[model samples]
Target chain A: MESESGDKYAADLSSIREAQMRISSYIHRTPILTAETLNSISGRKLYFKCECFQKGGAFKFRGACNAVFSLDDSQAAKGVVTHSSGNHAAALALAAQLRGIPAYIVIPRNAPNCKVENVIRYGGQIIWSEANMQSREEVATKVLQDTDAVLIHPYNDRRVISGQGSISLELLEQAPNLDTIVVPISGGGLISGVALAAKSINPSIRVFAAEPKGADDAAQSKEAGKIIKLSQTNTIADGLRASLGDLTWPVVRDLVDDIITVEDKEIVEAMRLCYEILKIAVEPSGAIGLAAILSNNFKQDPISKDCRHIGIIISGGNVDLSVLWDSLNK
Target chain B: MESESGDKYAADLSSIREAQMRISSYIHRTPILTAETLNSISGRKLYFKCECFQKGGAFKFRGACNAVFSLDDSQAAKGVVTHSSGNHAAALALAAQLRGIPAYIVIPRNAPNCKVENVIRYGGQIIWSEANMQSREEVATKVLQDTDAVLIHPYNDRRVISGQGSISLELLEQAPNLDTIVVPISGGGLISGVALAAKSINPSIRVFAAEPKGADDAAQSKEAGKIIKLSQTNTIADGLRASLGDLTWPVVRDLVDDIITVEDKEIVEAMRLCYEILKIAVEPSGAIGLAAILSNNFKQDPISKDCRHIGIIISGGNVDLSVLWDSLNK
Candidate 1:
């Protein structure tokens, strides 16, 4: 009830509410979808919060929009800068374009052509960096210094956490009786925000983080009771390869009930089901939630045996199907 | 203001309204979706009526459910029968299953394995016939005679047309200001019902039929001012190959404003856009409406140049992506 005052790294429920109000007019209040056939297969009433239909085709737009709009007149005048090679780059670019400001995007030189095209399409200024975190951060820092643009970290900022947290508010209102929510954990911004907001709204609601076993940092972190960094990660889920941020790690460790890791084969199976059964195109990270729920580990877990009404957050739909098609055929 | 009475082949607005009331509990009020990027690409504000999300993954379920439930006690006990190798067979099977009655499906032996699985999944009694219309009809006739079952034509029957017409009522209500509606025409059932109901609601509203260029019987019939059956049809849109039936022809001849035929290439392109941009999986038949609007004929038409708000009915989404993936790769 105190709103977590004077906490720079934390985003409380009040902050999330404020972010929702600020970004309400800019983003779509995307619909919640359900399928009986899918329900019968998974043996749970799964309500999919389709952020895949959100602006820029991902939930990243929510945090980007909130961060860009929260700037003051002088801060806004200098523009915004971020280094991302995934949906966040396009989202930030589009959000800045909507606000009539320059977005200096520092993308790796080896980033996908489609992603680069998305940034250009949204009128973002592209600054190329080498394909590594140190090079990316250095390149982004140089751009921020040159343009005097404010830096918006992908998942570490309080504004971004609060923005992503808006999804919980909307999802709860859409499906009020959802006892459990499963969200994909990448940098933990999405799951951290979701866990905090959902638990704040209803203390009894359980939040679970879904992570690809190939990149199971979140699961390791939960088991160790501390943030775990992997030297190398491997997964088909391009979006869920990032390590948890300092700001998000605390929220994840404290609020998230459990982390369910799924294999790449299971994720591919879930993606196939999304295409054939649900008639929805979800990227690998987005389908991981469904994969986690259907995993044998979850089924065998005593705590999850009675979880009837579950919510799955489909994070994004920006995958290039040509690549997926080739892989499937092989 | 009087409802058309004593007409066995006709389905007016009132009939559609009654069918809506009768089948309201069974079918989904599928949402209408809008996309700004799609509007910018097509030069018109498009409202997509997502009947692809309807029961059985197609709008055929509506007509099938209406026909199955309209039967009297003894007729219902005898069961329902149909001959097809498409969404209709699966839809009819599901509808009959819902009513706890037997569904005698006379599917061609050459029908795709996925389609057969769908019918079997819905508990239909599959009867195999040779890969020809005459063979299908003959097998269906035998089944009807043996079981004393009522024949439910996929499109020709009044109950079927009335059920299909319910789409118009829902679409018009969802998008109240749509000045034009483009619907994919197969056996003319869907467009006939849409034209009748849409015109009844708003006399000046334009109804256009989107047909595949390879299977252009509807376009030929419009020019001839009479029904013209195709000797052989060829198109990627398997759903649009059926010729207009006698009952549906009259409605198309009197009410449909125009027919726009698009090539297979355009249909594939629309399907790509539906998957990549709309983030929805639409079959070739379902993508035809969007393809027609993007066609040269529709763009150059003087009547359509001024149309601002348009509604596109995505008919069905039962496509096998493995086959599509092969073709696209090739």
Candidate 2:
């Protein structure tokens, strides 16, 4: 089914299917989680896309694998460059290695050691930058120019967005009757793709976007009908720190039904609940949907009571062991 | 499927099947993991039955659930009682609640607050005892006499042994081709049940037991041809501290092929590997099998290369969040 909104938000199914075929062997078709405990607690049957079990410890692998493989012979010869705190860099490196292409990553100076080591272990050439999102992007751009490597924006590229949509494709296939879906939004690539795929498959399926209140730029942008940037991102959920991208802004605005925010404390509490009750060890970002539900933040909203089976993309489950202590203390 | 051996260790098929009927609806038929990530590193094809996601946070629930449900109508009308540091107490509470029966849990004075809170949340009556296991047990015995409530020995009971075997039954059904299997042993209920069910189903499949060296009374007992009580059990894996008992010891002797010991440090390293590579949050006990594989401690054992497929039961995924820091630092 072709999306009516065109390329701005609607992903090309043919392109996504092609990407899926190319990267199918390189990535895991991660399991879908039907958490009985969650259902019994929330009174809503939950289906979680367990991408924490995906290769490279996240769903980032899918987009990275697809983007790296989608490169033509000339682009492959030129190599690839990306900026990430951790998972995307590692994913791209592994994906590039599969294609025998060189990969360069610009990592934050203070990135978690476990995540930094993962990039080096996967054979990525890492360049350190100031421990800020702006520094990462600027260094990556400089590296791309110096090395003549093509830039692969982690969440802005069409191939990456289409690749991420495959998760929802799989989810809707496994659970065709899902009436509502919520996705954790960082730069909007994941939520944009998920919303597009979900709405296309079943237009009546309500698509929600959850962002950490510390970095709820996306929610603000959705209200303003344009991109909104924050001066500082201060959430324990390091993954959902970025504001929505220019390409993702329009898509999220047009396709997504609602954009909600969860406080940092709620995120931490949700992470602890996931560990204690589900025993799944979800990182802070991965627990936002659950946080909203468990905290009753979602019940008072426009989301209707008729939304029975809720499908939530547990975006990423990559947490540094160092963070676990801080979480316990909190 | 009944073991005609008539030894206290022998668990008949009817009892095992009855446990299945009792807890099947309440617990997750936890996923079985077969991954190249583990197999490639271990020099053996690995099949892992992840009970880390089990209800009440551990495989102890299987035994506790069964023991609670196995109570006679008259006895259940009274209540159930037991003493423990954590997991067993919580499991007993959950089990008794499902049966609409009263649960009196005698936990040690200084038991982890998280465990105590979980018991109370499940509608169980809490009885505080001396912090040490010795005093805890004495108080539990007195409570049983005074109350005439059934005392479900954490691991020494016949019903518990039968219930714990359900993991092996599920593993055999999922991966019947396995030639060797490993399980972490504490009170020996899990190993006793797994060994009986696995060997009974496929007699050629060798069943091995892994334990932390600090609390290796189970291994020592098997070597000495009798149960050897530990005056002071010490291990990072608090769950595997108890020694095997009369009922569980006989089954360990008759059915289990070999018992291997691993250091606490090795367990921590294995837990890290599981978290990083397998994307699973495993407690120290859950790491026993992988620890043996990582150390090459049992690779030279009689279970040769041709065993083809090897299965390990990751008995639980319940690590107190506070323990994560200790594991990471180790």
Candidate 3:
């Protein structure tokens, strides 16, 4: 895909391979988990790539580490910058700290207190932005102009996309016979990278994107054959409210076999199931893939019909306890 | 240790080693997890042996599998029987199912609904008993007499203790530099097995026991240098309410370095931290080891002064969600 400035940023298998080597020591090789109860319920063997256990409690660490560490000494002198709701901010901050560089994070003022604390704990300087996409961009741009810091776009950068692809390299090696890989899509970085890497390894392996019904821009974009932005997004999956970016849209359109949409209720139910059966605390965004499967949203896809062995990426585990408590009780 | 009839049922290093080999294919070798956040809070390096990820969602599986599979063909034909309030019942049921043997579980009518469901899901035939220890024992005896089924005592049996001891074998290999190991004490089965195996592997290694303050029989017994029984127990850690068994008392009295008691409030706090920091669902009993450390209950122990590297057993993750919600809200 080409950016507005006519810059091409495409992720390939070779780049992903290099990214894996780059972040090997920096990131955790999280375990692939299975539960008999989950298997029986889905009627298929499921392998969960638990990035919820990943360093920084998410897969965002992989991309953030790759982007921060890939910079040259001169480019890295001013450090990195990013605007995120939660995981990416903490990830970039930690990655910058590990590289002995400063990180400037522009976060919405309404972001969870725990997430804000996580970023500060990793030594990031935070700049509060008004709670909207445009305000976040404005604040990030001002920071960039004042500090000359390089912006590390969460899901739109080439390095970040390639870095996220490293998950497939590990997943494929961990469970080689997987017929379908389900990923929770937000700005589409995870699914874009995973699809490229998985299809490169085995063309027959299908990759499906799962998104919350409240923020189904990616699903709508896939059907319309172009990128579509949502007017308003409302879901408990706070991490997946962002719309698809230009860099990730082309990859999603060409490589992704299907997109599955699940309700907010389904996301909460899957979160509870992950706690009960998988014995892990997964945020709503992380559990959405399983939520789609449990809700039978994937049953309409022909490729998913023959899927005997499925792999899922638990994207992250960072949620506000109060919010979770309220939703679970409801 | 000997039973009242003077029948010996002691577990040695060799017996534990044998149990490891016998159940190697049946049980999971759960990972040893570390978190920098956790380490910073505890003021020491902590290695968590996550038995919560074990089959049947507890370390009880290892013991149950060992006991059920150790049966000779003639004995196997009759199947197995047990009465448990939670994990052990489900563990034995699943183990028996794996061996193609019928499992008869005598559960107290007041046992948690989820635990009862787990047992039934594993194909165990349930025979309900009145909600009392004496009633459970009588019902188990009657079932054994009527069906000719062998009883697999949860923690008292030699085979079960040996099986549970295998966790120490894996922990030692995974992190050989540990100076102390902390385990939750219930009937003292887990701690007894762990203490024996860890001390045998490294005589210098200290093994500590953690119990809820409301149910501190193990601590009382250790302090008195004799087995002590509690007439009534009160704690949120339902799994640790049982007093030390006769076969386990001698082992704890001789080998356990210290027993620390934590209040119910501390356990709930630790449980919340596990959810927030480790991103894992740990039941009250499973979290008591960390709870003890967090409460500073072990500060007076002289041996703990030299302990830099510590290992803790997260025993299980089978909690009632409604109770957890209430505790967390409070």
What TM-score would each prediction reach against the true structure? 0.95, 0.90, 0.94
Task: List per-model TM-scores for chain B.
Answer: 0.94, 0.92, 0.94
Residue lDDT tens for model 1, A1-330: 222333434788999999999999989898887888889998999999988888788899999999999999899989999998668898899999999999999998866576677788788888899887789999998998899999998888889999999999999999999999999998988887788899989989989889999999989988897788988788878888888998898888777888899998888888877777777778888899999999997998888977899999999887776653344234
lDDT of each: 0.86, 0.79, 0.88
Q: Give the alpha carbon lDDT tens digit for every residue of B200-286 in model 2.
A: 777788888898888889889988988997888767787788878777887787788888889877888787777767767777788
- Residue B163 of model 2 has an lDDT of 87
**B73-135, model 3: which lDDT tens digit per residue?**
889889899989989999999999999998999999878787788898899999999987899
Kindly report the docking quality category of candidate 2.
acceptable
Give the clash count for each candidate.
0, 1, 0
| lDDT-better candidate, 1 vs 3 | 3
- The TM-score measured for candidate 1 stands at 0.95
Query: Which lDDT tens digits does candidate 3 get at residues A1-330?
Result: 333345544788899999999999989898888998899999899999999888888999999999998999999989899999989999999999999999999999888787888899899999999999999999999999999999999999889999999999999999999999999999989898898899888989988888999999999998998899988898878899998898899888888888899998888878878888888889889999899887766776666669989998999988766643443334
Cα lDDT for residue A291, model 1? Answer: 96
Candidates in order: C-alpha RMSD to true structure: 2.9, 3.6, 3.3
TM-scores of chain A across the candidates, in order, are 0.94, 0.93, 0.95
Best by DockQ: 3
Lowest summed-lDDT stretch of 10 residues in model 1 chain B? B1-10
